[model samples]
Target: MKIGLFGGSFNPVHNGHIKIAEFAYKTLGLDKIYFIPTAISPFKKKNQVAADNDRINMLNLALENFNYNSEVSLFEIKRGGVSYTFETIRYFKKKFPNDELFFIMGSDLLPKFHKWEYVEEMTQSCQFVVYKRSKNINKINAKKYGIKIMNNPIFDESSTKVRQGQLALVDVKVNNYIGNNFLYAKEIIHSLLTAKRAKHCVAAAEFAVLLAKSIKYDAKKAYYAGLFHDICKELDENESRAFISQFVENAYDRKLFPNYKLHQLAGALWFKHIYMNDDEEIYNAIKIHTSLALELSTLDKILYIADKICDGRAFAGVQKLRQLALENFDECFKQVVQRNIDYNLAKNITFSDEQNEINNKWSK
Candidate 1:
């Protein structure tokens, strides 16, 4: 009987971890692989990892399709405090004294392996299996410690990338789990908006997902763009003007319109500066969510259309526009923009120079 102990924070476990586990199971002929999600990792900051239960749940979701014999252990999490490899190895060794134990880790950790507590005793107690990362294991050093390196398919993914809204990089189950739990919900932006505005954001995000899927765009990014589209909408006139002054070149020009109309530009700047969002697609989508642009990306068009037709909106012809959006996005977008122009004319609403320029360009 042989057992493989794969331990990590498993902070929203990604494909890399699963790939390594499968490779080890087949190559090593292990009877069972235990995924040990740590309560706290000594190497990571407190804020860097998700809640203990959240991580465990994500790991479970990731492992549901595994054909091999595998199970998650809460030993380190139950033990509480800092999780040490030596203690975990000793506990497992005592549990199955007769069975061979193999501890799995990535090659990136090899350089720091000597720093681990009771390294000598732990090595003698269990065989070490190293999965290749970018670094190559030193054969001499590895042989000296009786460590075996397994060559497996390399998946370049990190939990940090996933946390930053790269949801498409992860498994569909993991993505669904994160969304269901609102695991990394942007509380700051949500807190800033009013209740009604928050509801509208959610509805827009749902609609954006559908629109994004129709065009093969990344739906998660679209969802996020929609969710934060109106984050600055609730700010008072003075506050909105002050905030926009720092980002937009001609902030004073924004004062000409009703203050509410400036939120799109303000929200884009907020996302860039506060949220540290580097995705230009998301930034541009947020920027043009309110007014039309002469040239719009697929994402920009999707967010604009989603905001207008989302369930919360109840204007004349909205239902028709929503249906048109599903069947013909380009035509739907053209009509929606035209509707906005017509509504503005009916209400005698003033348009900004940028808006007028865009309208004139598109009208031609």
Candidate 2:
């Protein structure tokens, strides 16, 4: 029997991982493939990786989606220590001594391959196969170790990116699992904000998801933007300005806005710098959510309206706006902007020409 060993953090097991496993299984004509999820990677930080059960569950969900001849092995997770490639190869070698063993890895790890624990022993125990992970040049030659480099297309998936709120990169089931379990960065919203504000954030996120589904936009982006839109709202003036000055470029004008409005700018930057999220749409939506930007995207409008009429906020006409948001997005968006303008006018609050223009464009 021919068996393949595909191992990685599999942090959330995105579609890219599944594709690589499928390619290796077919290309090597393996009778079966075992996906080993590491409890602790020697290279990655301990806190950065997801819990073992969560990773295992996501892998199972992703593999089940493909219905391929693959199984997830808990050898590394059960071992309960820093997972080294040599140790895994030794364990598998004992388990499948009579069968041919092939170790599968990504090209990104090629540079540090020789530095791994017992590298010579692992190479001698099993054949090594590498798939393209990116368009980077390898520092070391694969032929030096007799490694078989597959001409597979590069997969742009990264668990780091996925953890930073790029849910679209993962499989549908895996994405759902992450969402349902509140895995990854979703739970961090509470730690960064006050209780009342954190609850409001979750409420806004839920409402944003509804609005996103109504408009057929990406719900994940909308939810994240809404949840973290007020991440910097409670920060003192000094700290807010410090973060803005350091992380937010082109903020000469934003710093002059009232304390109430600074969170939008600060929150966007905090989400990027602290959470390491790089989705421009989510960043823009969170940045302008408090003061709606001109020429709004559907996602932008959804977040604005959701933040205003979420269930946590209590005010006249909120229920009507909420109903309209799910029923007629454009009408609801226009009304929400108009109300914001009216509220500011009643409170004797002066808004900029940009805010006025946004009102005029949408109110018409």
Worst-scoring 10-residue span by lDDT in model 2: 248-257
Which residue runs does candidate 1 get wrong by more than 4 Å? 138-140, 186-227, 230-364
lDDT (Cα, tens digit) per residue for candidate 2, span 1-364:
8899999899878878888888888899999999999888887854577789999998988877665678899999999989888999999999988989999998878887888778888888899999987777584657778888887878888887787666678877777677555577554566656789989999999999999999899888888888888878888877777778887554446445656668888888766655556577887888888877666777788889988999878889888889988899998988888888888899998767777786788877
Clashing pairs in 2: none
List the candidate 2 regions with Cα displacement exceeding 4 Å. 139-141, 186-346, 349-364
Tens digit of per-residue lDDT, candidate 1, span 1-364: 8999999988779887888899999999999999999888887755557788888888888899988999999999999998999999999999999999999988878877887889999999999998888655656557778899987777788776677656656677777777555565565445566678889999999999999888788999888988889888887777777888886666767455455468888888877755555678888889878876788789988998899889989988899988888888888987887887888899988777877898776544
lDDT scores in order? 0.82, 0.82
The clash count of every prediction, one per candidate, is 0, 0
* Model 2 superposed RMSD (Cα): 11.9
lDDT for model 1 comes to: 0.82
